[model samples]
Target chain A: MFYRTSGQFKTSYTADMALFPVRQDAILLAIILAFAWVILPLTASEFAFQTLLIPILIYSLAAMGLNILTGYAGQLSLGTAAFMGVGAYACYKLVTIMPWMNPVVAILLSGVFSAGVGVAFGIPSLRIKGFYLAIATLAAQFFLVWLFEKWAWLYNYNASGAIQVPTLQMFGVTVAGPTASSHVQYYVVLGIVSLMTILCINLTRGTLGRTWKATRDMDIAAELIGINLMKSKLTAFAISSYIVGVSGALFVFMWRGAAEPNLFDIPLSFRILFIAIIGGLGSILGNYLGAILIVGLPVILNTLPETFGIPISSATVEHLNIMIVGALIVFFLIIEPHGLARLWALIREKLVIWPFPH
Target chain B: MDFLNSLLVQPFADMFAAPDFLMQVLWEGLVSGILYALIALGFVLIFRSSRIFNFAQGIMVVFAALTLVGFHEMGVPAWISVILSLGVMFVLAVSIERVVLRPLVGQPDIILFMATIGITLFLIGFGELIFGGENKIMITEELGIPTGEFIFEPFGGFLLLEQKDVTAVVVAAVLVIALLAFLNKTRMGRAIRALGDDHQAALSVGISLQTIWVLVWFIAGIIALVTGIAWGARAGVSFALEVIAYKALPVLMLGGLESITGAIIGGLMIGLFEKLFEIYWGQPLLGGNTETWFAFVLALFVLLFRPQGLFGERIIERV
Candidate 1:
């Protein structure tokens, strides 16, 4: 079988512990990165780069962040969009107040701000579990959105009550804002997304990750075994929020270039949750897969009908898109609740067996 | 006495000073509460039987209302349209049971919940496709529901009450009583309670899961219809109604997901309290739109105090 890993051998622990242990995987990743950097910029239109690629990268980052807390830690959070809003607003304020500061640092600091808020909201998890915790998180969603709406200072008292992203430059090269080249913005987002993905993979494979899994699988047993519930849970929240916060910064600063409180409302939160579910919870690769399906499918639906000359109205297409996504979610849950990641894994397994019967 | 009356008691004093106004506000809150209770009832029925949170209940309300209006727009008689809408809801319930629920029988609670979200999205799309995605006025008068008003003069001031408001409250009360009786007296009702209590045990006792699911879903559909009509009569039938349906989420949180009585009590309390707060404090301090989130904040506090809610059975976790 072309997919067989039988010949793969590791001579050292470092090799075994590499992010992609298989040489084929490493090569495939390199090719993917090369294609993204060299080919996509040359071929992709401005709309494709801005709408399709940028948003997917941003949401994948957010979904990965959520994967750490809700997927790995077994917490149900409905405040993801709120946390992202915090990051976006915080970054906006930071960049405005200190024009000399680097934009990347501003983005990281914004994540720290979201982490603080995440811990405060996550405290309720100590007392509640399951749906109760989900409701508690909703409080954070409503409260944060309300605070942003009423607190004029957050938006710098813009007459329209929306935050506009200023042009971002690093080393005199425009990195963000309307004037920034699509290729520059794409590289910036791609760079951040890649780093975050590496960090998430490292964190999830470490001792802290084990503690999370332990807590998720059995909290009482975890406690007996010396895992501090508060510490582990809060840490998960902090890291998760930090990742999501960065995504928010990128979403507004790089993708949308403007933001309003309603832009990060409950529907956005639900959409991210759907992305996580359809992608496969807990799997790192599943985040990207889920984002592509959930975010990309509508675009595909719109284009495919046109290509076929079906003459569907845009409104009807939008409706049918929603129905198909809904039907797919139900179908996925019924057939493979583990998500598309599981389906891919199954295909790989079958390929490994080749022509031989099991 | 003047200071106390102005600060502490004037709000109620003002209400009584114009008895008609007090009656008007109270009637408005009551009618709104009944509609909220109807939506909450749909949610409670599904949760009671399946233990799955039906996020689509609000969409179902919109869908039912849209179907009725869509039928009317097609030259169907109002009475026939009502029957057709009911039939559509029945078909919806049966298809959902067969296609969505049956396949997802043994899934985790969260997955089932997510599937309902899928159902919600599908219904939203389907509703818009069929009904043309525009607001439609409720045919209240044509449906033989009164649109007359009653005026009361108290303390030399007049209060106006719509006859529709009166009808809504009375109908809701009768529906609640009928539901309570059905739940307590019927064989199917017993089976539903048993299923909610323990699925495996109910299966052991020979309850058909499919039949019970269909019946509960039918009941929920009926509740959705009633809610759609009542709410549509107030705000017109449109997707915007989905936002009002979200008002029921806070009610469910305060009432507990599994309790019908809690849904009723919580709906009324939130309805009355949010209106009162918006009028008295919200307008004065926060510029009045606080009604949007005041009930949710209240529910959040209630959850902090009593996670099981007023009528919910206490949950005991093992290990």
Candidate 2:
């Protein structure tokens, strides 16, 4: 069998609860990491970096942030994009005000601003739950977007009402702005995403993670068991927003290079939510898988006509692509409501028991 | 001190100084409120029946409007096109029940909600593909609705009202009356209420979930069509109408999710308050377009005080 574990007996609790309890799982991760870091960067073209690698990573991070709230902490927020806007705007202000500050550090620190906003909006969450809470988060969404438009100071009183990324360098090689190469941006994105993802895994596996799970299952029950609903919900909001904010900053800085207020609107929030849910709500790895499918879908749709010598207008392709995505969401929900992560778990289970009638 | 004076006194002074303008703003608010109520009714219907928050309701409004306009463009008579639009909505309801809702039964509410969003996206793509992305004119003249404005003179000032706006208000009033009558008098309607009240108990009494779900969705579709026409008359039929449908969510929050009366009253209240705020406070003081988040913020504060909404049943959480 591919995943044979005949002699992999654990002698201690630590061994039993290791990050990768199975030897094969660790090896598989190592192989995946090797491909991501060493192989993909060297092999990928600028188009691939922009269209696939960088976007998938950034979206995965964003989805992870949402997953922590909706999936782990059981708070549904429809306003993720606004928080992202907060991070992007905050980062813009930080770098502009203190030109000597490092771009990477500025991006990392931008999350704090969103965390504050997230906590402020999350106050209503202490009183509201379920669909009502979803609508409450939308209050945050609309108000923040309005703020973005009205509060001229957020965009620095620019006539255009858009933020443009200035050329930023780390050790004289530009890492952001038009002059920066996709490869450098990709590396910066990959490094941050990987580090944050590792941290998320550990956090979700720790005491706070269990507390969140308890709260998610039933807040009343969690409260009975001495878990402070306020703290748990608020922390989930803060951490989730923090991670989401960093991803948002990276989204504009490392990927988009320029952004308007509406760039982080509801549609973008929904797209991130799609990634998180389709990726497998509470699973870290699901974000990457979900992002790949969602991001890759459009590219594949655009190319199919050319690959097969078919004649189709780009507009028609766009319409069809939307239809397919909509249909795909329904199709996936029907096939596996638990999401792609659960599907992967099922597949892995099957793989483990292959060649035998267990 | 100056900022406080303008914030508190100036807007009220402006409203009193232009009483005619005040009447116009209130009238505008009432028309938009009726439209918001109509869309929220669509949401309330689906949510009551299946506990699925139909995010597609907005797109449904757009689709219904587009279908009507599309049919009229194809040489179909206006009234016939209206009937055809109803037929399309029925098919949409049936297919949604069969393909989407049936398989999604017993899932979490959030999952069901997500499925409806998927349905919304699909319908958007499909509608855009068939109708194209251009804004089409609603055949107001062909429908026999008047196009002239009615002016009333009182206190040496004139209040101008578009005939179409009057037609929309009258028709909406009639539709709500009919809807209320239908819900109260019909056998199928009672089944829907029963299902909403207790799912298992209703089934045990031989209520057919499939039939009831299709009926609710179709009724929601009907509401969507009516809303589309009313709104299309004012703003023209386009996908941009979908954004206005989002206004219904706050109405739903303010009125209780299941209370039909709540939806109507909440819709009207939000409509009035948002308009008044935008004109008096939001425009002169805060720069305009406060209508967008005004309803949501108002609903949020209301929720902090009354979580179940003004008319919604108190939530009884059992842990």
Candidate 3:
């Protein structure tokens, strides 16, 4: 009832084909943008902006990357965290070693590195599918993490074996560093995430995206229809890894500011995969929704107990938070396997016919 | 010749030079193999019947061990604690079957796999809540499992074997025999095989899938208990044991998901190979710590050779 889209009409093809055809949606999105840009900077606490919002934006981007390969392409990849690690480490080395290079170019080049690695690992998909492919990808996850840890040259022989994000500035404005404010970091992540999200949506809706869908649905049928399985699968891997890599770069540089090999372990991969699953797999908007649930739930779970004046230990809360998230995953899968995106669509459908139960 | 003698020849020469050490390594690998086989068996049972991989089987091992130790700490008699732990596992199986599996009956394989992950998270939380997030030593002696060591002097070197290791092998052998008999000779076992062979056909034959699912999960629970006890005795009961459970994953990959004998053989091979690699090749060449990924890499090579695994049925793609 609150979501009624009644009386909204479009005449031109361009108008009809607008990202959000409804004027109300456009207005709503504009308000959201205004809040993010103007109000959030003024209102949100430093901790909230840095920890909650920035991490969510960065992880949502990574989840979006995994969604392209796993959700849309029907490949079950467990190496997302590894690919993200590749991007983060590559960006770190490139920017620090080549002091004159632009940060954005370093980040993009890091993504290219990840894309190359992703395609190499994705080659096994030609002979394997489903669980077999998932297992094969695990090799990538373990091997890459081990490489990062053992190869002292990668970390420039740091004794601690961890990477520190160098202070980066763009256009004389500090984008990342101790001097940068929480709002600046948040806005930078928000900008990159938004741009990537738009690009992802465009790519998934284009001809290449249809090829991915066809391959996912029925590879044999897709091949029968003259779709090149190798080309389509490799493209999905390359593009998906590129997105994941950029997200990883942004995550470390903009959010974490430091990282260890432990940060890119299998559990991290599982966490990203969980976000993709809980958030709808194929929908662009579901990435944000899923990220919110996966990343926000623990915070809310931790805080809600305190709000009720309960004195639960933080560890207990962490455990309970895991339980609740797990329960929700099972609940969502059972209730609607399509994930939170389908629920949104269902609500929109009902809204279109609200006030009269037809 | 010196390089080859030191690098390659010394390891094998050392093995044969000390028959006692060779026997000890074989026994240690066999014991570890039994535990790995137990975990792999739980996964195999569920996969055979439902074709759904239960990734939470590792957590269940931790949960079962934690429950036994928790009850024992509460002053329950050793025998009573054992019974109580089994009851706890049974309740967990029933609840999981009803809550997670029942609702996700017809869902896609990946979705079901994810739900098992949810089950994993829930079990982690639930286990921690009950047992606290700390390691606890297994009461192997109190539970009537042996703790003494057997020493042998062969090839002029002393070799020691834990009594618990011998006990593990015997118990695993007995359990395997019992499980094999039950699977082949029992009516329910045939029904389970039928269900695994074809779900719809079994349903048409009036086989109660819900009953079989509960039964299989219950059996898996029992397997978890034995695995927990054995593994907990070796390494204290903690979430870190879940890492060891990962070793079972490569075992499954090499053995195939649905084959019992395959799991056993694959477990033994991985156990022996990983240990040998870490001791001889990994320590000398890579400076050790290769055990973590050696099994997975081996499984990767095996998959490249035979995607169906060592004993898995030939996979015939329909389309």
Candidate 4:
């Protein structure tokens, strides 16, 4: 009843190609957006902001970047955190070197650096396909991470070998650094995520997106059909890296407020990949859903034992979280390889055809 | 230029200056090479049978080592602890085949790979919970493996080779010979190779997929045990040891996915070259710790020319 589409008729191509052809999806998105933009911040405690809201947004953006490459383009990458490291470092350099520039501009431009590096790494992908490409990307992960550690210049030669986000004001409000309030940081993250998501949605829905799908489904066939596999695959890498870089910037400046070299290690890459896979590959909305589940569930699990008066240690809780997440990954793959987004789509389909059997 | 000389010439000069140190590096490389070969064998065996990349092979090593040590700690004899660990790995193999691999049998290679990663995480957590997160010493003395070093004097230079490393080499050689013989002589091994060759054709011949899977995984489990013991003997048993599993990836890439010979040769080559580069070239010219990316970089460069890996079977994609 909630998703019935009987009365909705498309009169033209523009109407047929609408982002949310079903009115309910738009309304649902509006409600969610309003909550994210307004109600969550109003009701959320500092703990909620720091742990759940901020992380979910940043991770969603990061996963979206990965989803573009892995899910949409059909390339597998195990080195997302390394690309993210590229973004974070680039953003840090941009800010430190040009202190007079707008922080948001610096953050956005940082993605360009990552995009270039992403393309450089992606060059190998033209020849390396499938799991081979995935392993190849680890070269980037290990090398770039090593560079981050060895090159003191990237971290501004801090003896600590970590980047500390500096306080920066955007339109008279401190948007980053220790002095920045969570509310302001949350808004900043939200603004960037929402913008990138829109861009990602449009990109994935467009011709280039179709090209990626073609390459992903069967590269030889796609090439036979005159699709330049190189261009398609490289652009996917570029755009995906750009979005990932932006999220990396947000991850450090907006959320973490401090960063270390090992922060962008293999484990972080695996975590993002989990979000992408569990949320559903090749879906924009899936990134957000996946991030919420991957990020939020742990927080909820941590609190659940305490709330229930269980005497489980925090370390035990952390272990259980890892176990559950692992089990969930297998469960999700077995039950629905397309992930939560696909699950939601199935439910929506059933609702759209309510009171009848297909 | 001095830079060119440092990059090119000095490393060779340094190597000639200390033949004993060079020998020491080569010995270090060979031990790690054996371990890498063992891990790669585990990967090859499981991948051949089920088409799953078996990322859990790394954690299996950790889990097996932990279980052996854990059982010994619980007052079981060292030999009994080995049996108990084997039993644990058998149960693990069965559960993984049933729970994880069964449902994901027809999924894409990437999905299967991801599933293996999931298995890795779960094993890491489970092992940590049961064994605790602290590093445990390998029961070398309990197992009666000699820990003394053997010294050699050649051309007025001294070379030190640990007895355990020598034992590791001998044991690994025997294991590999036994494994190759088993594969060639056994009915089950033939089934695994047939499945790797053609899944449907093998199924048509009345070979039980589940049994083959379970058997293959169990074998991988056995290899994992040997790897755990050998690696733990050197580095101690801990979750941190899981990082070396990544080393096996480059080995697999360099060796080829389906070839056992590829695994062994690739493992040894990567091990030796990475060590040599780290000492001769990487440490002096580049900053130290080049071991972190050296294997992967070498593998990547090799893969650019041969995407199937140097020893990998040719990949023929069909639309």
Which prediction has the highest DockQ against the true structure? 2
- 10 residues in a row with least lDDT, candidate 2 chain A: A349-358
The 10-residue segment with the lowest total lDDT in model 1 chain B:
B279-288
DockQ of each: 0.63, 0.86, 0.70, 0.81
List TM-scores of chain B, every candidate: 0.95, 0.99, 0.96, 0.98
Error of 2 at A13 (Å): 0.9
Listed for each candidate, the true contacts retained, as a fraction, are 0.64, 0.76, 0.68, 0.73
Model 2 C-alpha lDDT per residue in residues A47-90, reported as the tens digit of each score: 99999999999999999999999999999999999999999999
TM-score to true structure, per model: 0.95, 0.99, 0.95, 0.99
Model 4: chain B TM-score vs. truth?
0.98
**Tens digits of per-residue lDDT for model 3, B1-319:** 8877778788888777777777777777778877888899999999999999899999899999999999999999988999999998888889999999998889889999999999998888888887898999998989899899998887677889888878888888899899999999999999989999999999998999999999999999999998999889989998878887777888888898889999999999988888877776777767677877888888888888888789887887667
Q: What is the C-alpha RMSD of each candidate to the true structure, in Å?
A: 2.5, 0.8, 2.2, 1.0
Model 3's TM-score against the true structure: 0.95
For residues A132-162, could you state the per-residue lDDT of candidate 4 as single tens digits? 8888999999999999999999989889999
What is the full ranking by lDDT, best candidate first?
A: 2, 4, 3, 1
Candidate that scores best on lDDT = 2
Enumerate residue pairs that collide in model 1.
B20-B159
User: Residue A159 of candidate 1: its Cα lDDT?
Assistant: 96
* Native contacts retained by candidate 1: 0.64
* Steric clash pairs (candidate 2): none
Docking class of 3: medium
Tens digit of per-residue lDDT, candidate 1, span A292-329: 88889888888999899998899999989888888888
